[model samples]
Target chain A: MLDSLLQFLITGVTVGSTYALVGLGFAIIYNASDVVNFAQGEFVMIGAMVAISLLGAGTPFPLALLLAVMATVAVGLVLEALAVEPARGAPVVTLVIITIGASILLRGVALLVWGKDFHAMPHFSGDAPLHLGSATLLPQNLWVMGGTAALVLAVRQFFRRTSAGKALLACSCNRTAAQLMGINVRRMMLLAYGLSAALGAVAGLLVAPITFTSYDSGVMLGLKGFSAAILGGMGNPMGAVAGGLLLGVLESLSAGLISSGYKDAIAFVVVLLVLFLRPSGLFGKGAVERA
Target chain B: MHMRKRFFGLILGAGVLAAGSSFAADPIRIGTFLTVTGPASFLGDPELRTLQMYVEELNARGGVLGRKLELVHYDTVGQAKEAVTFVKRLIQNDKVDVIVGGSSTGDTMAAIPEVEKAGIPLISLAGGVEIVEPVKKWVFKTPHTDRMAAIRIFEDMKKRGIRKFALISGDGGYDKSGRKQVLELAPSHGLEVVADESYGNKDTDMTTQLTKIRATDAQAILNFGFGAAPAIVTRNVRQLGITLPVYQSHGVGSKKFIEMAGEAAEGVRLPAAALVVAEQLADSDPQKKVLLDYKAKFQAKHGEVSTFGGHAYDGFFIAVEAIQRAGGTDPARVRDEIEKTRGFVGTAGVFHMSPQDHMGLSVDAFKMVEVRKGNWVIID
Candidate 1:
């Protein structure tokens, strides 16, 4: 029983790390701009698919991955400039809807380019399962967890230490005040989107070997990542990572211990409960009033 | 002036005669609605291509029943509502004599009532048993049902002396129906389902379920799902070091499954149509010639030969043969001839339709094949 519990944890953490990366992407964009980028999942898909196509063309693995992430960052920049920037100063809801439209457009374009086929990326490391006591885990799982941790740390440092990150935070807190302080708010927004897209691309690159990649695969992952972001208090990057891991663990344990059929239901129920009890999410600070 | 009037009258008379003669040789319309351009396009695109190619070929060889075949197809885009609308349009506007489409079971089932109401014979390409179980008078299907696939797997297990097995399925429509069939048929086959599990359609990982199955005392594992999920399950099964025999349904019969699952698909068994291993079949096998012929013709035009396309081949020929045997496009006579079909060897199997069994395929229609070195090999 204990061995199975450990096994479930391993599975949960592996799956959750991908969600954390995607959720972190959501958090980053949400912090920089109040518009929830529904297209964040498509960034993951584009990253993985571009890498697969490059590898199929006989490109080296590392270079293919690098180019793929860069391509996805370019796609994110294009999306912001074309779809989001044109609608600057629009209501956040409209911007969110625009991102949703952009996501659909991206999916359609991907379908036309790649067709409707699922692609598998060669594992970064060997596929031999690593044994831990009575439990087993794939080397890819370690890459996902480790990659997510490192990226999370890098993102946190960018926010806390870097002047540009501080400027972005200032924009998130109050755009007018940050602009008054000579911060180029638009460039900061662009940086946030680029960084978020890179994070999403890495998540896709890490998980593609395990889950396979397709044009429409982003739809569900994007929703789950959105849920993770909300569960982590919407705009807190670290909180989104924690929420992602927590949600993954809950799904895995419930699937292993209770019933696999109810796994998704139980996980979402917990998210709902968390939202009901604390509207700001598990890690969000409650709203403050200045009288 | 009189000479000019007489010449005009002659020209008008020739025009009338030409139009009347052409009307007598009007083509027989075969209307179809397939999911040719959507997520399920993988199934419907090939089906539409097969129908078009065969119709062209048949017309070149002096058409069915001395009348050229007109294939009028609508891309349903894998939507059932669109399928119903297209079926209605085919019946009302196109004025087709026979229908041979419906790429997925949902599309097929939604179009059934319309076909039955219009009294037109529909040979569906989808694989749900429910489409033909209650014996809809106007509906017949070409593909083997999910029930037959389950029975085939169970019989194979029973022959191997394996008793208890676990079933892992997806929550998709096809997967749910397949799981239900396995559970319903397990008892009669002297098999016991030790554990039952399911995952969402878009689930990225299934290790939790695989771990649960690993802890079980199951003698074998049967996964009934389509798309990329089964491949993931196969890889996870290998990753977790579970060596029990892994059996998949016909849903993963395509070469893409082997490509996706990689080395993990080796030795994995599934019951699929004979078209998958067409070149490997012995000369004495009855389906060898037909399978190879269709494969060559389709590959020359399209890129690959999918079982879904083979389903269309069977459905189109069945409609054509029934029209020929009926002596005309009389709806009732064509429906009767389709029902009386017996030993009509096609791509899927030797179809034998009857009043009670609209599908007209037994478990023998499926060939038990295993993935060997990234290619399909007939094992049973």
Candidate 2:
């Protein structure tokens, strides 16, 4: 029984780290533009597919991974320049729809380019499992967890220690004031998009070896990441991590204990209940009156 | 001798005229709806290509039964709704004499009621037993059933004295049928299903499910998912370092599964049609000649021979034989003739259709195969 519990927890954490990465992608973009970019998950697919194909073609793993991240960063910039920038100042709902459209288009293009087969990559480290008493954890899980931590720390450092990052935060707070302060708000938004895409790409490349990657896999990843973001209070990076981990643990526990069939439903039901009790989410700030 | 030569030439001229006039009549129309362009395209594309190749060959030989064979095909894109719409279009608009399609069990089931109402002979490529069980008069399908596949796995496991088993399947129609079969058939085979878990079809990670299975004292694991899920499960099981014998269904029989699974697929076993391991089939096996011919022809034309495509080959031959036996392209006659088909050998297996059994395949039709050095080798 203890072994089972430990096993589920390990699996949950492994999957949670992946969700955290995606949640961060969502959180970062939400902070800058307040447009829920539904195409966030495709960044993950792009990263994994590009890296895997390059690896298949005999490219060094490190170079292939670097190229994959760069490619996704390019995609992120292109998405902003073409889709988001054209309809600047549009209603949040319309921008959201544009992102959704972008996601569908990206998914279709991926299906055509990558074909419909699921691809598996060899683990970056080895496949050896570290025995943790009753539960054994894969090496890839460590990569995901470490990568998530590093990204979170880096984002935190960027906001607190960098002038550009402070300007981005200022723009998120008040675009007019930031522009008056001589900050380039548009460039900050572009940077946010690029950073978010890189995070998603890292997540995808890290998780692909364990979970597998395919063209349509991003839809579920995006939804789960969105749920994690919402649960973590939307735009809060720390909240995204917490919500992602909590959701993953809850899902795994339910699947392990109650029923695997209703695992997804169970997680959503909990999230729904949590939202009902606290409308702004677990970590979200309740309505604050600005004087 | 001169008189005999003149008589032969006259007879040949008369034969040519008869053929030419017959060709002038309305052609026999056969419509197909398959998942030729979506995630399940792996199944549908080859099936469509094989059907097209066969139709072209038949047309080259003056078509089937004195009428030119006309094929109207649709890409269902793996959607059940698309399948139904195309089935309706095939019957109502195209006015096709017969329908051959439904690459997936879900699509086939969705199209069943419509085809039954139209009373057209519908030859399905999916392997779900429900498509034919409780036997709809107009519905016939090729390929072995999921129940037969499950039973085959159980029988093989029983022989090896491995009674306790773990079952992990995808929550799809085909896998659902497989799960049902294993649960229902386990008792008869004197086996216990120690653990039964399921994952979503598009689920990337199943280590959680595998972890649950690992807790069980199962002597072996049976994975009943289709597409990449089975391969994912295999990888998870191996990554978790569980060394118990793992078995998969015919769903993972193709080389694509092995490719996706890579090193993890090395020793995994599965129950699949002989078409998968045709090269390893014994020369004396009854299906060797037909299977070899299909593999050669399909490879020659399409550069690869997918086992799923064999379902279409069997379906086409069954329809043609029925048309020939009925002596016309009338739907009712063809439907009746198809019901009486027996010992009709094609790519998947020798089909024996009857009024009671629309899918004429039996458990014996499946071959036990295992992955060895990234290639499928016949085990039984």
lDDT of each: 0.90, 0.86
Highest-TM-score candidate: 1
Question: What DockQ values do the models have?
Answer: 0.75, 0.50
Candidate 2 structure quality by residue, lDDT tens digits, A227-261: 99999888788888889999999989998998899
What's the CA error at residue B347 for candidate 2, in Å? 1.7
User: Can you tell me the CAPRI class of model 1?
Assistant: medium
Model 1 TM-score relative to the real fold: 0.95
User: What is candidate 1's TM-score for chain A?
Assistant: 0.98
lDDT of 1 by residue, B242-262 (tens): 999999999998888999999
Assess candidate 2 and give its TM-score to the true structure: 0.93
Error of 1 at A239 (Å): 0.6
Return the lDDT, model 2, position B110. 94
Runs in model 1 deviating more than 4 A are A287-291, B1-24
Chain A structural similarity (TM-score) per candidate? 0.98, 0.97
